[model samples]
Target: MTTYHVQIKVMPLKDLLDPQGKAVLGGLHNLGLNGISDVRIGKHITLQIEAESELSAKTKAEEACKKLLANPVMEFYEIEMVQG
Candidate 1:
């Protein structure tokens, strides 16, 4: 088995409500940081896994994201795996 690095980014669907993101966006305006519009917050997860090859590592990462890292109903995720 080879060690792999996995990164998962989970983001809300376009139609989902992101209160935390909205709040942050509002605060940006208060801090005089304009031109930043449409703020949305999600989750960033990084981990190490053991797999046979790049394809195996990617498949495992994707499974992990779908099973626990992201909510299919409201969120989507992008997965990246690199040799470690």
Candidate 2:
């Protein structure tokens, strides 16, 4: 088995309301920066995994995101794997 570093980014779907992002956008405008638009906030999770190959590591990381790191009903996630 090889140790792999996994990164998972969880974010709301486009149609979902992002209150924190909206708040940030509002604050940016308040600070006189109105050019930025459609700001969004997301969660970044990083962990280490043990797998037989890169493919297996990726698969396991994706499964972890789907099962525990993200809420499919309200959020989507992207996963990245690297040698650890």
Q: Which numbered prediction scores highest in TM-score against the true structure? A: 1
Which residue window of length 10 is worst by lDDT in model 2? 75-84
TM-score of 1: 0.92
Q: Give each model's clash number.
A: 0, 0
For the record, the alpha-carbon RMSD of candidate 1 to the native fold, in angstroms, is 1.1
**TM-scores of the models, in the given order?**
0.92, 0.89
Q: What is the C-alpha RMSD of each candidate to the true structure, in Å?
A: 1.1, 1.3
Worst 10 residues of 1 by lDDT: 75-84
Off by over 4 Å in 1: none
